[model samples]
Target: MAVSTLMFAICTAIYIAIVLFLGYMGFKRTKGTEDYMLAGRKVHPALIALSYGATFISTSAIIGFGGVAANLGMGIIWLVGLNIFFGIFIAFIIYGKKTRQIGQKLKAVTFPDLMGKIYNSAFMQYACGLIIVVGMPLYTSAVMIGGARFIETTFSMDYNLALLIFAAITAIYVIFGGLLAVIYTDSFQAIIMLLGMSILLIFTYVSLGGVTNAHEALSNMASLVPASLASTGMTGWTTMPSMFSPIWLTLVTTIILGVGIGVLAQPQLIVRFMTAKDDKALNRAVPIGGFFILMLPGVAYTIGALTNVYFYEKMGKLAVAAAGGNTDSVIPLYINMSMPDWFVVLFMLTLLAAAMSTLSALFHSMGTAAVNDIWGRWRNKKPSLAETKAFVLIMIIVSVLLAYIMPGSIIARATAMFMGLCAAAFLPAFTHAIFSKKPSTRAAASSLVVGAVAWFLWTAFVHIKESEPLGISMLLFGQNAILPMPWQVVDPLVIALPLSIITLAAVWMVERVTTTKEEDAAEKAI
Candidate 1:
């Protein structure tokens, strides 16, 4: 190996050694399923905050959505605001305390477990678990792609090898040490991410001669937008697309709104609340989480937009054009070409940290969901730690296969797709479970079915981006989509989430009326 490659390898080895040491510490502390799944429910506020933030902002946020910003321009900034406000403020203050209290009260160890206990029905657990097992791999795959892309860029390694290695390394701790290991390592990764992102923003601004100059340079290139994008409604890097245009709807409904509101129902994110020791910990986490959120996505999006300016000035090409048409490559390409060698190594570690932190949490959640809700329910027993480990290994392989099969330039879209489905399927039922005095199982069930089905139907038929590739609509309807313009561009979450909410409300009201009448009529001599 070259001297530089050898030095970089040494640094990475040291970092991984530290992470493994922390994982071992977690292993030593873990005494039972509770400790493995919920970190013994005594995590410090800072650890909780960092773990949550790190898990929330993965490689998908940095490399994937950052690349989206490069393609779609600064308009992607809306997502950062929603991430902080809805994902942090509303989530911690409104949902965290309730989830922590109720989870403790009912001895719920997983998200599905909490739902099942809330409704006094094992079916709730089974349904939620099935969703996680089936749907989470798409997201997990996308995150792996983000990490592998950077590793491929950094080490000049084969994409397939990078993906397998990334998957295997991230799986080790999650398989053996479970959630506690995930939490400690994720917290450490979070600090790395903060430093990396902070330096990235600084370097980007300095390269472009400070913030104002960068924004102006990007703004001045409005007329340079590609014909395809401009015709679709994109105005420029610094401005929103034309209202109700195809690009505008896609940006507003699909990218921005999809992920913005979708964060509420994410299984991995919600489980963080269950690990909190008390309401005070949750409260203390808010500002810390908010700051972390502001720094990561905020910097990613800002730097992404500015990369266009850098490319235009340096090579007389747009960011996407400079990257040869693949948006996913834009951020990675820019980093390699623009940053110093030492910074490249540092940022490579950041991407690794981002990917591993999120992947560890995802593997832990999926494994526990499989054990506590699906397989364990089938076996009619509390699953052994060995069983959870086995399932974690299985899930890692599944996600790795998915990452291999998924097409290029897919990271952002897949992330949105997963988040949107979660919003449509889980948001209504999850909200009802934690807040309602008596959450209606029938209502929650109906909502889950309708929401998931609606979203799938829309994606497979009406949403052009997905439907065109899936070819389901073509086979059934003789066209890529069953609809024209606007509707084709509208995100499924926009339509399905409302339907889910309405289904739950309607069912709950009907149940309330019938139950009241039945009570008045007496027990019918049973």
Candidate 2:
């Protein structure tokens, strides 16, 4: 066998061995549903931090969003700031502690369970569970696609085969070991990701003749912005797109706000708060999680934008152009061309680590939501671990099918859509569940239904890319959209989130007034 191939195979085996060993350890220690679902709420602060970070920043951020950076330029860095601020800082500091407290007090094991119990409504759990089971596969499929794309580009494997392999490996640990295995493996993967991304950043800058030189070259090439993008207010790589332009609206509102604020409502992420031992653990994890978040996107987005310069120098073509206009291909193609063959092997593992860590968490979340929150609630019984594992296998199969059928360059949009949906549907209700004293069940239910439905309708009819594919807009509204350009392109969250908040507030106020009147009447009679 060729030396490089042999070395790669050996390294891959070792990595797999380490991951499987950790999964087994988690499995051995797991004793019950609590252990499986939340690691008995005794996970180390560092493990919780690392697992949360790893799960949050998956191949979607590294490969899909990285490719976007290559096409969109440094302006995408704004998202990094938002991720650190909203995703890590606000998530852990403002929400994490209370979520853990409430989760523990209520003995809630999952996000849906927490919400349902807090609201004292079985229907709430069913609704929340349904939202997760239905919406998460879109995000999961995006992650699968990101990982599969790397494997396809790196090893010249069939995309479908790569996806199945990826899903199978992730499912083995997650379905068997549950969240315990998922988080333990996630910590291991997080380490690999940090090293790989650090090395990638240094190598990227060195290859471009240092940071200053790279930025200068990239900045000077503003004229290279494609006419298609330029028409949509793309000024240059370094600067933000024109304010209120269709492209600008999509980037800031949907891509940035949707994913950024949406992190607060993500069940997979929210469950991490419950995994920690105490408020201190959650607090201690804040900076550590923040650092990881800062590093992943800070490095990935920077390198993604800088790749444009590398492709321009090496191939005399832009990164997107050389990759045949496929945004998803930009990262894998850049790595193959610019880095050493050995590094390619290592980087491929890094991407695998990223994809697997996230896929495991997602699969675990979906499985538990399907079985414990949805089915178990309906049956008025607790589901056994084995039953949950069976459902996990089903979820994996469905997500794999989605990964196979989703169109190219669908990764980023899918991630954004799922996050946007969560933000609209769950954020208002979730926030109130944690903080409000008299959170009305009716209000929460209305918000969940209205927000989700609004987001879906907007995507089907107004989100230009999805609208055309779904053909709802074209079929109903004709050639021109029912909404105009900026409105059509603006993310659903911008519109739907406010509606959800309004619904929640309006319902809650009415409920509160009625309760006060009834209490007053009873007191007077007494």
Candidate 3:
């Protein structure tokens, strides 16, 4: 069932050519710093919606999370609902419109710039930017690993070579054309992804003899559930895992809520709102964004779960077993074994699109943080497009190097860990900034510090999934995690995000009370 590598290479070349052409168009349109950094705040509504959707649904979401769906069952569909609800509807209607208006009024160019300007504090800008510069690479490197690993395996190329090629191609556009180029190429890539996933869904359901039969067949395979998974509460491919079981906690908290709620504060995603011209654009984009988000992960997760029936029928083995128990390999293995030769090429393009779209946005966000927020704010200077581009190249190199250092398992945790961190560090303060008329700088600072610190401490000392590998807890306390059973299994986001919000609310109230008392004393003296 292997397809022609030469054919894949040719199709990939054409895809890359179109992407580069779009990037070139973006560069042509980019005539000022605003154009380069914020797409001139005049991007088309459809383009904004498509680019935002593309940036959110990366290769990790499609392949890694899809593989998760294959192994963990259709229960992961909960995340799809949250994605549309929070990632699109709420993000655009509640956050995106506000962000657009405020960002335009303040002339904010990046997420950190928005924060710094809103607070009127240079320290706020630097700290936000610093967090992005330091933590974004963990997510960025995970993305690089996903895309490059696919290229290496699919075309039989060297991993290092694949990594370099992916990095260089994405960097060239982002560094030269900036956010304008990133969005332009993103819209183009989004189309490819939509087409590719649409085809994947049709092919999967049709090949399984139809939707009803596929579900029935999969449900029948409940008895085929591996003993290992059953012990952890897996019921079947179609049902949710046992409530409060280890699997349930991991699925619901770590996978579902960690990413679902975490999407609100993603620096790269928030930056897309700043690219909008007005509330009208954001309002118009809601349904478009919602539909785009639905098609991408919705199709991936559904097709991923149904892949079990296909494998069971063809190989008499389940999806995970068919791929030799490596969940990461499940989707690719299914495609190679079951899909048509032409579709293989298209799917490969789909993955590349997912990777490039997200990567370009990450590069832009990181670079802007470095040049515009951190360095420029510190020096009290306005950064030029050239300087930001240089920093973009630097961040790209940093992320590529980190990809070599980090393990492939980061893919599974990429969305959860990175988004969790962003939510913990920025979400509360970001919410306050946009919604509160008289936001407290002290409260914002304290929340950022507390949230980030709490998230890291929990990851390093309490979350067994992360702590066990980190070995920090074992090194310090002779244990993998400081807690036992359910506590160890619970995700950091669940612990840290609430703590972050509490810290913000507590401090803001304290400051408000203090100021009110001071004003009363002054009035008595007068």
Candidate 4:
């Protein structure tokens, strides 16, 4: 049943008022750049956990990748396990603690601050900020697309209008209140997300009869697998794709490993650790974040896969075909067709919250990177509150422009691309900052430059999409990819990450050997 216009209006009005109110509160409490960027470093455990978790899981996970699961099958559930183990547990327990300790030790306010201070190099800070400014909007654009698409579907509104409204509202709070507003709103949004997803889980089971019955029905869908997909090694909705298959390569390397492990180096997430009050807050946040991480994606992937069953029964077409082969549309169409009107309205808000929470973080991270790290280095001074706020508005405009211009069916791939790029370019240096001291400015610079260049070259020459436009591969190899079939489909991370690590190791070794020789010569002369 369609939602009554009255209910829709009431729900929307309430949600908007609450969002604005929280922004006001954040603005009232915020006093300076520190408060704007790091929430004054006095945030509690629950707020940090929820804010972190909410920032981590966005519409890309709930809607875009969820739709991919519908077509690809239950194997995507592996991402849920990975997200909890790597994204939350390892991130919070290992990386988060160290980041918090070292960040405070260095008076670091952003990821760039942490890196630059650890290495005592201004270039590291400036380069890191430039990268975030240039690349993070891709990720932010994905989040905006997710929320805007949902609003478009739910209200039957124009996509452009939906996109603008979503961007504008999120920009309002983030611009005025800064990180405090983002975190405060994020905690509340996380609550709504949890409630919304819990209800989605229950309804999915009820619709499919029961838990066992749902699995049984999905398992029985083996023969119904599309012949084209099966040709590429798709087996059944309940089974994993064939090993070394194209689908398998994309799923394992790109979707699962790319995002799951890449969370370690995400700039926005790293800053969350700096917002906490103490180690106790960091420790206290583990389980809360773990639970939110586990449940949200767990439910999303399950329902995503099961939506195939729902669509198959109602329309005789699989989820992908039912949504016109556009994977991005699968989840929204399923919700509209299978769910009641009230639930649709509720889920819309859940998605809106998810998108806004993540976008707020991304925008704030980008703004701080620009004003604090990049501009501060140029000026040899810290950014004032007004400068930070102005940059936040600039980032919002950049992200909105990207969202408007980005291709359709790109939300998931864009998410993966940004995450993969961050992992490739930032992970080695970021890890070294905490775990090793031998990496010099040269090593950091070489690793970052090599990692970023390798990833871009691969994408532009070897990857299918950008390669078409750039024609680097076509010019050099007379083909869209220089590699053979299996290698061609492999994600950039599979290549770039190893190269990044090796560069870091090689430079560090050279620095050590060079220093030792110089010291020996000085000693002999003495």
Candidate 5:
């Protein structure tokens, strides 16, 4: 106990010192709203890439989703592919240059600002701002919960206290130094996370004897898939289930597609494009960001699946049962039981780096939305630097309170729900704004409402088996009873996103035809 306490204290001191140093540097450079909010629009591309990668891949990827992969098997690797193709490649090459150019053209500093300028609507600005203000905290709370849970598991501290401490430390840096501080710390945290995961992977492989032995051990446990889940075409981790089964639906839709395409619409990530110094900077950052995002999650998930090798060999049970059958606890249990004391200390720092890096970005985005988008719009004024700083404080306070009060499971579910909703709500409007000419404001506004409302309704009523007629897809197909079809499992994004685009195009066509007829009548009368 004494040794563990001393190790914890030492790791804590190093983390705090590094963060405070970054905060001081940010404070020294920060001069105006531009500096605080967008890193004065001069951040180098490498830093931008690191910042974007770190913010996008957080505790949710490492701890939360890693645990999920440990239970579900290699099917989740589909998400890693999606992250590479959609999250980094297309997002940077296809969308980054245009987004940066347009943001500079309009002097837009936040996502809401970009939306408002594109649509020429003050109402859109406020609406987007409100969405960020309300929606982002749910994501933030999940990150906090993941970090706190790991800390609680390792240190045996009260979970609420762990949550508060994690939230408070991140909030302080974010509140003081804003975006520049967040990115700087993120760069450092990303390095730590990369090193830590690499070490964990190496150790895990060594513990299992080698690659071939690990595969053999996993294959021997093929019958371990729970009986209740067997009828859904669920197979064990050694192989993939039949295509288009419930297991496949969860893997393809929820874990893979939900997070993969969802990356394009992430506000926190989009703003990082504006922070880069130039197109060259964006170009420089791409490989760096893509490499880190791919490697870290890939390693973590691979190690997570190998937990079965250790658990089955030593304990005569799966890691899921070894961790008391809680999916979220599997990774923690493996780390605690398999690693030595020294590496355990490093793992704690790695978890902290992951959680704090992501939390700082979320807080920065939320505060900017509140100060620059919502309050500034309502007052019909631009916020002073001092006012923006105060708004940061307010956001930190609110987020910390939510972290302290909310359940971890609830936070995780809500965070996933928000990501799906954001994809639905903003992807269409954003795509049209950048690529389409003279997009109808009526279409943009209506689509935003339809997407948000549809997501909420589906989440509340249709998605649940017990609440409504069958499942979500069944309800859409006019089925009043449960459908056993794999495709019948509907994620809100798969439905709401297509509906939003259809609504936007349909509305725009009707308005365009009406305007053309009116113009013809006016010319004839003249």
Candidate 6:
């Protein structure tokens, strides 16, 4: 125990030193709001790539979802494919350049600013900001829980204490240095994660014989799949489930489609586009971002599946205690028990780096959204620099409190909720703004109201198992009961996104026809 504690302390000191150094650099560079919020809008391509990758792949991916992959088998690999194709390829290549062009055109600093300027509506800006402020805490809490859970498992520390300590440290750096510090630290953290996961993957494979033997072992344990899952058309990890069953629906719709499509609409990520030097910078950064995003999650999830083999061989049962008798503990337990002490120390640092990188980005985004989007508008004049700093501090405090109070199993659920909300509320308006010449204000407003209400209702009442209707989803159909068919099981995004697009188009058509008739009457009268 003394050795383990000493190892952790050394690793922590090294990690904190690096973070503080980056924060100092950011502080030296920060001269104004623009510098603090958007890294002076001159972030290098490589750092942007690293920042994007690090933010996208958090402890939620490594520890939380890694556990999910371990329990669920190789089926979770679909998530990695989605991350590359949608999160990186489409996001960076297609959306990234276009978004940068538009954001620069409008001088938009925050995601809410982009929406407000594109729609020419302060209401939309406030609405988007409110959604972020309310919804982001859920995600923040989940990440905190993930890091805390890992620490608690490995070091036998109090979960609450772990959560508080992690949140406090992250909040301090982010509140002080903002986006530049976050990006600099994220680049460094991304390196640690890549190296750590790669080493773990190699070690786990070698320790449990070889790749071929690991596959054979996993194949032999096909019977271990839950009978209920099998009945729902989920075969073992070796094969895909049926096309549209619950397991397939959950995997494809919620995990894959939800997160994949949702990446385009992620505010923290979208803001990265604005930080790039130019279109050339964005273009150059795409491949680097894609590589890091693909490799880290790819290795982590692959190792997750292989943990079953490790458990069976070591414990004679396909279970690890850290996971609370669940499969999610498979990765953490494997690292703690299977790897050498030095590697365990390395893995802990990797996890800490992952958690802090993500938290810093998240807090910075939230603070900017609150200060630049919501509070700044209410001020008759621009706020003083001190006021902006105060707002950042307030946001950090709120986020830290939320993290401390969050439940343990909220990671996946919170992720889905935020992604789903972004897809429903922002996707249609954003698409129309970029593609259409004369997207009507009425259309934009109608889309926001309809999409936000529909998504809230569906998720809160109809779709979720026991949520109260009026709580959020009550606006849809004015009922507190669940909907039937795909709505019952499908993610709310599937319904709300299409509904928003259709509503926007319908409103535009009506407005166009009305204007045409009015113009014809004026010609006749003249």
Worst 10 residues of 3 by lDDT: 406-415
Off by over 4 Å in 2: 1-3, 524-526
Q: Candidate 5's residue-wise lDDT over 85-191, tens digit each?
A: 88898899878888898899889999999999989999889888988898788788878888888888888889889887887788788877879999899999999
- lDDT of candidates 1 onward, in order: 0.92, 0.89, 0.89, 0.89, 0.81, 0.79
Tens-place lDDT digits, model 3, residues 251-289 = 999989988999999999999998887889989999988
Task: Kindly list the per-residue Cα lDDT of model 6 for residues 374-445, writing each as its tens digit.
Answer: 888767355555666677677667876887765545566567678878888888887777677876878877
In terms of lDDT, the poorest run of 10 residues in model 4 is: 461-470
Q: Estimate each model's TM-score.
A: 0.98, 0.98, 0.98, 0.98, 0.94, 0.93
Q: What are the clashing pairs of model 4?
A: none
lDDT tens digits, residue span 24-89, model 4: 899999988888888899899999999999999999999889888998998999998888898888
All candidates: CA RMSD (Å): 1.6, 1.5, 1.2, 1.3, 3.2, 2.7
Off by over 4 Å in 1: 1-3, 523-526
- Once superposed on the true structure, which residue ranges of model 6 sit more than 4 Å away at CA? 1-3, 320-322, 326-328, 465-481, 484-487, 523-526
Per-residue alpha-carbon lDDT of candidate 1 for residues 235-296, written as tens digits (9 for 90 to 100):
99899999999999998999899999999999998989999889999999999999999999
Per-residue lDDT of model 2, residues 1-526, tens digit only:
1127787789989998898888988889888877888888889999999999999999999998898888888877888888888888889888998999999999998999999999999888999999999999999999999988987877878988989889988888887787889989999999999999999999999999999999999998899999999999888888888998877887899888988888889999999999888888878888888899989988988898888899999888988998899999899998888898888888888999999999999999998999999888988999988888899999999899888789989888899988999999999999998899878899999999889999988888887888888887788878535787778888989999999999999999998899999999999999
User: What residue pairs clash in candidate 6, if any at all?
Assistant: 67-328, 456-473, 457-473
